[model samples]
Target: MKNTYFLKAVFTLILCGFFSMTYAGTIYLSATGNDSNNGLSMGTAVKSFSVAQGLAADGDTIMVSGLIDFVNDPGNTATTTTSGPSTTNKVGIVITKNLNIQGTSSDTDGFQGVDTQTFINTRFIQLTADFTLGLKNLKLINGALITDLTTVAAGGGAILMTNGAIVAENVVFDSNTTSGHSAISGGAIYIGGSNGSGKATSFKNCVFNANEGTKGGPIYIQSVGNGGKITFEGCAITNNLANGTTGGSAFYIRFNAPTGKPEINIINCTIRGNKVTANNANGGAINWSAKTPNTAYVNIVNSTITENTTGGSSTAGAGIYFAFGTNATGNYGNLTVSNCIVEGNKTDAGVASDMQVKADAATGTAPENTVGYIAVKNSMIGAVTSLAANVPTANITDATYYNYITTLTPDLKAMLVRNNPDDLKVRYYTLGDGSPAITFGKSTFLSPITTDQLGKTRPSTTDISAGSVEKNPVLGLRKNLDSAILVYRNANNQITVENSTNDYTGSITVYNTLGQVVAKTAATGARTTIEKSLNAGVYIVRLNTTAGSAAKKVIIN
Candidate 1:
C-alpha cells in the first residue's frame, strides 16, 4: 500500500507539471571575444552563439551578451535558401540540443530597462530534435523566414519548432515577418507545420506585439500528433497584423491529426487591437479550425479580448471565430470560457462584433457529429453572432454573475496609453473607474495562471482588475437621488434618516467606496436616528424600499 501511494503521488506531481530541471556548465558568448579561447567563463568568452553552442552539451546554458547577430555567423546567414527541412534547411543557425539560451538581462518590457537585452537579429531558429529549451529575458527582432520553400510547412519567421517544447519567459517577438509570396504561416513562431509533431510549448509574461504573416499574423500552431499543446499565461497578444487574405490576425490554430487531442490554454492574458485585413476572413484576434478525426480543446479564463477588427470580412467574428470538422463526425473542437471579459470588438459594417462560432461543412464522410461547441460561463459578452444550439451558455447574460459596460460611469472604453507610441512597451488597458472588473475574479485559481500579464502579482491572486493592470476596488457607485427617501448627518455627527412616503418601509444601509457596509438600520416609516459616529467622507446610502432597491450618496460632514 505504501508503494502504491508513492506511485500515485508521483503521478499527481507529474500531472501538475513538476519535474527536476538542471543546467550544466555555462558557455559565455560576448561581442568582443575570440573563439580560440575556452568559453567556460565570461573572461574567456567566445564571440558567436554558434561557437558557444558547439562547445556546450545538452542541458547547458549559453549565456549571451550584446548583439548576437546571426547574419555574421558563417554557419547560417540570412541569405541562405534551402528546402525540405530534413535537418538541412538553412537561412539560420539550427539548435540541435536542449540549452537555455540565456540573455544577460532582467528587463523584457520590449524597450528600455536596466538589463540591456542581447538582441537576436536577422535569422530564424530551427529545431531538429525533441529537446526542451528555456529562453529568458531577451528580444527577438527583425528576424525573417527564408523564401526557399513555398509551402506552409516552411513557416516561422522567428523560430520553427519541429519538435520539443520551449518555456519562454520575459521575451518579446517584435518585427518578425515573412516574404508574402513565401506562403508561410507564422510570423513570430511556428510549431509543428511539417510531419514532426509539436510538443507542449509555454510562454509566460511574453509579448507578441509586432509580427506579420500570410496566415497567422504573429503565431501559428498545429498538431500533427496527440501531444501538442500551447499555453500562454500572463501574455499580451496585441497590435499584430495578419496580412493573409484568409484569416487569423493574432493567432491561428489548426488541428490536423487523425487521433490525439490538441489543446490551447490562455489564462490571465489580453488579446487586443489586432487586425485582419483580408477581403474575407474570420477572426480578428483568433482563428481556429480542426480537421476530421481530431478534437481541439481550448480553455480561456480570466482574460480579456476586445477592440480587434477585421476589414472587408462582411460577417467576421471580430474577437474570436472558430469551426470544426467538415460534415464528418465527432465534436471536432470545443471551447470553454470562464470569468473572461470579451466585448466591444468591431467587424465589418454589416457584420457582428464580439464572438462567433460558425459552422463549416467543408469535407467529410457520412455524418457522425462533426459539430463545434462552446461553453461560456461568467463572461461579459457584447454580441454573439451565428450562435448555434450546441453552445451552452451559463450566466452569460446575468448581471449578478457577469456585468456589462453600458454607461459611461463604469465605461471600459477609456484605456490608458493604448495609443501612446512612446510607451508601447508597457501599455495596458485600464478597466476605467467604477469598473465591474475590479475585484471580479476569485482569489483561488489554478497555480501557474494566477499572475497578471505585466509580470506582477495580481491584486487578487486573481488580477482583481480582470484584464491586465491590477486596480484597487474603490468603485464609485453611480448615485441617483431618491426623492421620497432622505438621509443625512446631524450636527452632532449622528446619522439621521427619514422616509417621506408611508409606502417606503425597509432597511437602510450605508457602505464605503470599497463595497463594504459600514452602517445599517431598520426603517419603519418613522424618523430614524442612528447614533453611530461617522467620519467625514462620501458613503453610498441604499434603501430597500417597497418599490425597489435604490442608492444615493449621503454626504456626512
Candidate 2:
C-alpha cells in the first residue's frame, strides 16, 4: 500500500509539470462593439487594446478584434472625421514581454478604424522596455503622429523607443507624422538607446509608408541616454518625408554619445521615395552624425538605399551624409557598406558630399583634421551619369539629381575607400548585366535575388564605372577579362596587375573615359598568367565564353 501511494504522487507531479510547460497565456480584446469579460470566448472579448496589454505576461498572446482607433472618436459614423487618432489614446497595444499580439483574419477581427487622418494625431506603439514583441498576421496602421505645428510646439510626436529590444514582424506603420516647427521634428518611429545596450530594436518584414518627420520621416535611430543597437531586416521604408534639414527619410542612424553609444545594422531592406527637403543638413536619405560612442558607433550591412532626394540644389548627401564631430576625436566610428545597393541618391547644384575626406585625402584642404571614417568593400558608387561632366543640384526637381552618382572625386567622396575603386571587395561573386547598383557595396555573403528601391540587384555588374568584383563571374564579362588588374599607381608611372579571379580565360582591353580602347591583350587557357603596364584610366573588359559573351570594367593604377 505504501509503494502504491508513492507511485501515485510521482505520477501526479509529472502530469502537473507537463501541463505547465505546454501552457501559454492568452488574452482576447475587441475593438468592435462587443465587450465581454469572459476572456476565453471570442464573442466575449475585452474592450481596450491597453487592457489586453496590461494583462499579458511573458510568453502570452494578445488577440484583438474589431476596428478601433485611438485617435478618432469611436462615435463618429463616417470614416472621414476631424478628431481622429489623438493623444487621448496612446498606443493601440504595447507589449513588454516576449509575447505575441495577433489579430483575427476577418475584416471584423482587426483594428480598421485607423486611417491617414487619424494617424496625424497619435502614436500607435511605443516600445521601450527590454523584450521581444512579436506582431504577426495583423494589419497595424495609422500609428505615430505629428501634431499641427501651426498651433503647437514642433516636438512631441511618433513612436519613441528609449531603450529596449523589439521585433516588429509583418507590421505596417503608415501615415505617421511629426510636422516640423523649424528644428523640432517628428517621425513614424523613433528608436534610441539611452541605456548603452547598443542593441536597441529590430524591425523584420515591416512596411512603412507616407510617414513624416522633420528629421527622419519614416524612422529615426539616435543615441538617447545610453547607446543601444538598432537593426532592420527584410523591411521596407518608402514614401517617407522630412521637412528640410533632417536626413534618412526612410531611416537614419545617429550616434549621440551622451554616455554609451549604439550600433546600427540594416540588412535586406528597401528604402525608397524618402525625401529630404532643401536647407537641411545631409539631405542624403541616410545621414551619419559620426558622433563618437563610448564604444563602437554605426554599421550598415546588406541593404539598399536608393532614389532618395534632397530638397534643394544647395543640399548635400543625397545618398549619405557623414557629418564631422569635434567633441569625439579618435572616437570616430566606422560606416561599413557591404552587399548592398546605394544608387539614385542625389544632391543639388554643387556635388553632394559623397564621402568626407580623411587624413591622407585631406592633407592640405580645409578642415584638414578629418573626422568622418567610412569603409566600402566590393561595392559600386557612381552617379546615374558621369559626374565628371555636369554637377547636379541638391533638389529632387533637377533631372541630373535624379541620376545616381558616378565618377566621385575620391578626395571628396569618402574618408576611406577600401578594397579597389572598381571592385567591391566584400562579395565573393560579381553582379551581372544592366543592374543600377552594380558594385554599389561589398558583402560578406552571397547576394540576394530581390532588387532595391530602383528594382536593381544589390550588386549589379555592367556598371558605368568599375564598381565591384565578386567571387563568381559566371555570366558577366569576367570570361573575357583579366582576373587581375592594377589598382593604384606610383609616381614612377609603373602599373602592375594582380589576378584574383578563380578562372581567367578572357581577353583584356583598356580604355580612356572617351570609350576608346587604349590597350588590348589576348590570352588562352594554356597560360593563365599575364603582365602588362598601362596609363592610369578607366578600361573595359570583354570576354567570349564557351557559353556566351560578357563584359566588365578594369582600372589601371
Candidate 3:
C-alpha cells in the first residue's frame, strides 16, 4: 500500500512537468478586459500588455486587441524606478522570451493585419533574451524623451534588442525621439551586443519615418566582439533626423571585433529625405564605422538613396560614410552598391555630398593602411566626391553620372525629376524617352536582379537600365526600332502589324505583364494579323527577324 502511494505521487509530478513543457498556449489582451481574467481566450483576455508579458513563456503567442497604452499600465508604472542592464522598468512591452505579439481584428482568432495608422506609443521596448521575437501587423511609435545618458549602453527610443532577434513585418516606427542626452543614440531601434547568439534581425515591409536620434535617427547597431547581422528588405526609411555631434540620419553601425565582421544588407529599400543637422555630420542616410581590427560589410542592392543632406561646412557623404579604423584589412568590411540609384544627396558648401570613405593612419607592423573599398557597379550615382583616393571604383558601364543642374539635356533632366514630390516614399525618377538610362544596363548585373525598385521587370532581350526604374519593353522598343513598323489593335481585338516599306518578314510573339509569352504568330508579308483573341489589357508585341528583334506595346479594346 505504501509503495503504491509513493508511485502515484511520482506519476503526478511527472505529468505536471510534461504538461508545463508541452503546453504552449496563446494569450490575449484587450482594452475592455480586466487583468484578473485568465488571459487564455478572447473572453478571458487581460487589459495590460505587461500583465500578458508576465504570464507568457517561450514559444507562446500574444494577441493584442485594440491599442495598448503602455504608459498607463499599473505594473509598468510600479517598476519605472527599477535599474539594471536588462531592466524592464519604464521600457514598454519588455520581451524576455521568444514570442509572437500581433494585433488582432477581434478578441477571437480572427487576426487583422497591421494598421499603419494605429500604434503603440511608449517609452521603448527591449528584447533581452537570445530567442526570436516576432512583431507583426502593428506600429510602434515611441515618444520617449531620454536624457542624462553618458554612453551608448542606454539607447533605443523605440525598440532595443540587447541579444535577441526580432522579425518585424509590416510595422511602422514613426516620430520616435532620443534627445537631451549626452551620448544618446538609436532613435527608433537599437541592436547592441557581442554574444552572437540571436538570429539576424529582419525588418520586412516596414516604414521608419520622422524618428530623431543623436547618432542614428532610425537605428543604431553595435557589435563589440562577434558582430550582429541586420537586414532591411522592402523597407522605406525617410524623413528621419540625426542631430548628434556625428550623424547617421537613417542608421549607424559599428563593428568592434578583430576578425568576425558584422553585416548589414539593404535590399529593395528606399532611403531618402533624411537629414543630419550637426555640423560636419557624416552619412546623412547611413554612417558605418569599423573600430580597431574589426570589419563590417554593407551591401545596398536594388535601392535608392537620394535627397539626404548634412548641415556642416565640412560635412561629407550625405548619402553614406564608410570609415575604417586602424588595423582593418582587405575588402572584409567593404561597401558594395549594386543596381542602385544614388542621387541629389548634398552636404554643406565645400563638402563632399554623395559618399565618403575614410581610413585611419596605419599602426603597428601592418603592410598598408587599408580603410575599406567602395565598389559601385551598374549604378547611377550623381555628384560623388570621395575623401580617400582610389577607394571608390565606379564601374560606369551602362551607368549614368550627372550633377544636379538644370542645364542637362531635356531628356536627361526629366529622368532626374522626382515623380511625386508629395510622397517621401517615392524614391525613383521617371526615365524619359531618349534618356541614356533606358536599356543601358549590363546583362551581367541584371542577371541577379529579377525586378527593379518599383517591382517592374527588366526588358527581356535588351539591356537593363541604370537607377531603380527599369524601362518597359515597349519604351525600349520605341527608342530602338524605326517608326515605319506600325502596331495597333484592330476592331476585332486582333493585333495588326504593318511595315510600310515591306522590308521585313519575321515571327511575332505577345507577352503579358508578367513577362510570359502568351501568343505567337508568323509574319509573312508587310502586314500580318495575329488571329489569337486577346483580353482587354496591355500586351507587348515582339517582332523577331534576321535583322534583329524589337518590341512594341498594344492595347486591345
Inter-residue clash pairs, candidate 1: none
Worst 10 residues of 3 by lDDT: 106-115
Instruction: Give, for candidate 2, the lowest lDDT window spanning 10 residues.
Output: 389-398
TM-score of 2: 0.63
Over 4 Å off, model 3: 1-24, 77-89, 104-121, 196-198, 224-228, 313-315, 325-332, 348-352, 359-371, 392-421, 424-473, 476-557
User: What lDDT is reached at residue 207 by model 2?
Assistant: 70
Model 2, 1-557: lDDT tens per residue? Answer: 99999999999999998986789878887665343375655676767665566666678887866555555433222211135533433433344566777776423444442446543245555566766566655655545443333443223243556555566666666666665254334466666545434444667667777777778777666554454566666666676777656566666556666654456776666565567765545546676665553444455555556556776442356666554434433325545555454554555444433332122121122221223444444333434322322221221111311233434441212112222233212111223332323322333333443333223344354321122222223223322233343233434543323344435455644444454665566535443222455666555544443433444555555
Better of 2 and 3 by TM-score: 3
What is candidate 1's CA lDDT for residue 96?
77
Answer with 1 or 2, whichever has the higher TM-score. 1
Error (Å) of candidate 1 at residue 525 is 10
lDDT per residue as tens, model 1, 129-233: 778878888777767664645444657777877667788987888878765353577888877632344557889888888788887888887654464677888
Give the backbone clash total of model 2. 72
Candidate 2 lDDT: 0.50
* Model 1 whole-model lDDT (C-alpha atoms): 0.65
Query: In candidate 2, which residue ranges exceed 4 Å CA deviation?
Result: 1-18, 41-43, 64-68, 72-98, 103-120, 147-158, 180-186, 195-200, 224-227, 258-261, 293-295, 327-332, 348-371, 383-557
